[model samples]
Target: MAAHNHIPLPIGQVPSSPYYIHPSDMNSMQFVSNKFKDEGFTDWKRSMTISLSTKNKLGFVTGIINKPNLQYASYKQWERCNDMIISWIMYNLDAMIARSVLYFNIAAEIWKDLEDRYDSIDAFFTKMKMLWDELHLQSYSKDFQTTTRSEANAVLDEAQ
Candidate 1:
């Protein structure tokens, strides 16, 4: 029989409290339009850069609704984040459908009519190949009342 030595993992790699992440947080939740004089466009851009550059998937758009700042944020800012997040989710669904070679092990080709990424994450999803179906496309609409608090929370928990 051979004796073995067990090595311990580092604390940093142990996955402690990284940061409060909300999917909406990455969508520039506190961002006002470039027109808004007081708007923190810098924060918006910085957040977007951080989101895109992050190695963590949770750091992306999905973190928008997940991350909540203790400091007060305006309704406009929250609205902006919500709008961007919903749109991003729509685009993501569309892209996955578009880029998918197949679904559920079924023989299906969904990526037949979409383009490629233009500039950002939303752009990438928008650019993916997808067949235009007025009916099914409705499912991908932001108006769709599908996403819920628990649902998003579950996703966040799983990712974390």
Candidate 2:
């Protein structure tokens, strides 16, 4: 098996071919097993195609990471991106687990509330995504006062 394209998935009892496995789970398993230390990274990139159901497109906003040049990157470089995704997930997962243990009562903990109230991780992610996109553009537009003004305007407009 090609090292970069066929990292084993951590799904169930049976090990199937590369197609049926989830690239994300394969990435998590790569963390514990040194066998995945150098495993090819093709399995880690699960977002090349639209997920149809989630409708969430995956893109890296911060620094230069993998740019989806699937035809160009080497297995080693793929490994680096895999590491990056693992780190990002770890940070988010840490927040998620901490929020669960904290009983979901904190007002400053939106992610925790999302995780606790949502049915699945994907559902929580979709909600978080909406919050992130709407945040700076609308939620915090002018200041705290903008929220009240906007809401009052909307309500008044609705009544008219």
Candidate 3:
């Protein structure tokens, strides 16, 4: 009987390493089912993060795995991972939003830009909600109600 020996590989060669690209991983792959529109940035981000983390590629966008210097041997591996991450992000984004970050070279930079842009959107929505609530509260209610469409139209005609 022959005994099999298992050899341990370096982190770079391990499947769990961010630098290690699985044969199945491709640039055209869509990580999330729902494409991110201009709104719902928070939910979109969460979905993307989960998908990336599952692939063991979360560090590329999170900036935890820093890219090596251009001259370094590992630089190419890092760049490939970064590009793949960017592709996944772009695939899940709306066309307009994707174009806005298309020129970005680094995955982390794209992530940061998206975060900054969406934060402003969140603030705008917050302000609009507050205004809506205030307006709703200030609106007056009448005791008499018009039950039919014609009655409502008559009331509107009277106002005119």
Candidate 4:
């Protein structure tokens, strides 16, 4: 018989392939717990980003690496990686938030949804700080006119 080139098959397609074994679960302790708090969000984002990047799973969450084409040999491997990433994210999330995101089919959508929900917190705090600084800088006097102006400012600030 003539010698034939042996092309490797994609993972999970071949019953004997070692790639059929599942990957180890990601450690969740390093990431900030998503306690559904606005303050905890920044830490959670930073920690999760670092952890995912370290594991080379950042692309899955960022949508930079898409699922492989059906004809590709790596499709099964990609799916496994995607599922692992999704599980990592879910494992670190607060129960309520996890439930909300449980139905997401892709890691990118879950990442985007969480970002949209929590990323605005910084902006909100910044705006509030600016308003407070402006209020503090205003000169107030004992005179009726100045006192009235300060009162009006206080009302406006509270309304914000």
Better-scoring candidate (TM-score), 1 or 3: 3
Error of 2 at 78 (Å): 0.8
Report every candidate's CA lDDT: 0.35, 0.35, 0.81, 0.71
RMSD of each: 21.8, 17.0, 8.9, 6.3
lDDT of 4 by residue, 53-126 (tens): 76666878888878779798777777777777777788787777889999998888999999998888765776
The number of clashing residue pairs in each candidate reads 17, 2, 0, 0
Candidate 4 TM-score to native: 0.65
Regions of candidate 1 where Cα sits further than 4 Å from its true position = 1-71, 95-160
Tell me the deviation in Å of residue 128 in model 2: 18
Model 4, residue 96: distance off in Å is 0.7
Worst 10 residues of 1 by lDDT: 105-114
How many residue pairs in model 1 have overlapping backbones? 17
- lDDT for each residue of candidate 3 in 1-160, tens digit (9 for 90 to 100): 9998989785558886788888888888887778988888878888889989889988888889888899987888898888888898998899999999999999999999999999678767766677557445545444233246575456445433
Candidate 4: give the clashing pairs: none
Which runs in model 4 stand beyond 4 Å of their true positions?
1-24, 27-30, 33-38, 133-160
The TM-scores of all predictions, comma-separated, are: 0.19, 0.20, 0.74, 0.65
Instruction: Please provide, for model 1 over 1-160, each residue's C-alpha lDDT reduced to its tens digit, 9 standing for 90 to 100.
Output: 9989878543223332123234434432332222212133344344534543342322324343243354644333433433443333333333444244223111111111111222244433333323224324645778435767686456445433
Q: Say which candidate scores most in TM-score.
A: 3
**Residues 35-60 of candidate 2: C-alpha lDDT, one tens digit per residue:** 21112222212322122113121222
